[model samples]
Target: MEEEKKTVRAVERALEVLLCFASGHEWGLTEIAGQVGLHKSTVHRLLATLEDKGFVSRDAATDKYRLGLSVLELSANLWRSDDPSVALLPEMERLRDQLGETVSLYIRDRAERVRIQAVQSKQAIRRVATVGARLPLSVGASSKVLLAFAEASVREAILSDPAWPSQLDRSTVGKQLDEIVTVGYATSFEEREPGAAAVSAPIFSRSGQLVAALSVSGPSNRLTPDRMHEYAPAIMEAAHRMGTISG
Candidate 1:
């Protein structure tokens, strides 16, 4: 005898509700209902379930819904895998060509970032941080990224050390590191060298350990906030692709 197949409408609706947030924006119940083409009560009930599971959150002031920390946790897992160096360099060069900015790859070297790869921009006014150059992990975007995702022991050792850079104190630097973990990237504006601005994305090894950072930097005037925002998505997309390939 053949048995009829069964489907769960509630589960399907829940997934659709989650997808509505793909634009990186928040939503209210009515808006979510409209987006998902569901009844208002049904959407509200689904939201409650997602909230209980730490998948969504509601703003008390605006009564809007947003993705929760759980999303970040899931993303952080991707950054935890694969040593992506070989798979990353070609794309980095391509990104450098596409953006007309300096691209650099760095690996953690005991609380510092050692530039292991780079592709310089053609523009004469561009930034010029060369390979094998060592920079403090407490100041620049690349170094801070390595620090943020490092193992607890390594992270604590550097942060609590007396040698923490005199230019930026531990607490301030610590907050910045926390933010990097939350947002998945880092930014620096002439903090290391005057006239330079940069944004950086982290690279991870296949086993999920922090390995290196990839960055794009240039003259601050040209690498303005809008420019960085425009380029950030491509930078992150390249990183995520490398993440999937790094051994």
Candidate 2:
């Protein structure tokens, strides 16, 4: 029993080390050690094992570590089986083509929103999404859309958290979520990334539960609020179609 408990604890620590990268894409050994509250030696050993398993990659030049292809491969497998990413790709692609902007699918993961699938535009200048990338649920259009439709408990916890980004006003967020629900979509301009703008609509399950968000993102100059409003119908239509197909 002692040996089994040790093994379980080791596994838990390794998983915690891997999860450290979710906040930022890369980390140094000491940084990860600090983040996970483990000693440098233990973190190093866990990193070595994760590196060997292709779950993490180390930058030879900078000596920083980032998540590896194995993580995306697992995400792809989930996408294929029952994640709705595969089923929704065609709609995402079609929306990208129609809007001439990058299209992405996002789902809530605890206090974050994760990009599960993306279709890039053909234009020379456009937004590009990295699959499996986790973003804060505070400022982006997709994140707001997901939050607007999320369960009341989940919504309250995030809004009430003292760590919530200072730039966001909770009362305003409340109004924005209400507007998103009333308008059937949400738009953000330079809210998170400078020069970035997006319009997102919620995708619902057959039972009317929110499942994901479908978004069209591009340069703020191009995806202006006026333009985003113009594109809203198309995005909402595609989101509805995606929900229909998945259902």
Candidate 3:
């Protein structure tokens, strides 16, 4: 039993060393050891094993280890496989064409918002939100909608984090989220990025749980307050359609 526990601790320490690389930093043996609180020899052995498996590699001159190409290839493959973003691309494209603005799909990762997919309109001037971009949960129409529909425990976890960055007045955001929950949709009047306005609705599963958010964004001048209201019904309809298909 003691041997088994020691083995588990070693594995956990090794994983901690690997996680230290996630900061996009090149780390030497001593640095990795210090970060994971393991002996230098233990760190060296673990790094060598990872390098043999093509998970880590060392620079020829610097002798510092970094994530290898195999890790990136594996990540790319996982990103493309039956992801919700890929499943909804066709629908997103149709919506972008109909609305003449960029359409985006986002999912919550704990307290963070990640843009999973997007379709851009062919307008001469366009607002583009990049796929795979991450944003704080306290800002943006899509993020706000996701937070409003999220489970109370999850929302509280986000609010309890002292490190979470909030730009707007927290009380105002809290009040606005109530309205979004009541209305079943959210809108941004030039919040988040400057000169960009967006309207978003929550996508719910067949079991009535919020799964994702769908949004349409464009220049603030083109998506004025009245225009956002005009487009809200269509956006909500699209979100419902996506939920039905996904479920």
Off by over 4 Å in 3: 1-68, 76-82, 164-167
Model 2: per-residue Cα lDDT at residue 20: 94
> How would you encode candidate 3's per-residue C-alpha lDDT over 1-247 as one tens digit per residue?
4664335866777688788875646999888888888889989999888889888999989999999787888888876535678777888888898899999999999878988889987899888878778888887889989988888788767766786665556667667888999998888887787899999999987789787999999999999889988999999998888887776
Give the Å error, residue 218, model 2.
0.4
Better of 2 and 3 by lDDT: 2
Once model 2 is optimally superposed onto the true structure by TM-score, how far is the C-alpha of residue 72 displaced, in angstroms? 7.5
- Superior candidate under lDDT, 1 versus 2: 2
Query: Relative to the true structure, how large is the alpha-carbon lDDT of every model?
Result: 0.84, 0.91, 0.85
Q: Cα lDDT for residue 33, model 3?
A: 81
Please list the Cα RMSD from the true structure of every candidate, rounded to 1 decimal place.
Answer: 19.9, 4.6, 5.2
Candidate 2: misplaced stretches above 4 Å? Answer: 1-9, 20-37, 48-76
Total backbone clashes of model 2? Answer: 0
Q: Give the Å shift of residue 128 in candidate 2.
A: 1.5
TM-score, model 3 to reference:
0.73
Candidate 2 residue pairs that clash: none
Could you tell me the TM-score of candidate 2?
Answer: 0.82
lDDT (0-100) at residue 106 of candidate 1? Answer: 90
Kindly list the per-residue Cα lDDT of model 2 for residues 148-211, writing each as its tens digit: 9998898999999988988889999988898888999999999888999999999998878888
Residue-by-residue lDDT tens digits, candidate 1, 1-247: 7999788988999999998887547999999999989999999999999999889999999999999888878867654323344457788888898899999999988867788778889998889867667788877878878888888789899988888867677788788889889988888888888899999988765678666788999999999878887888888887776676675
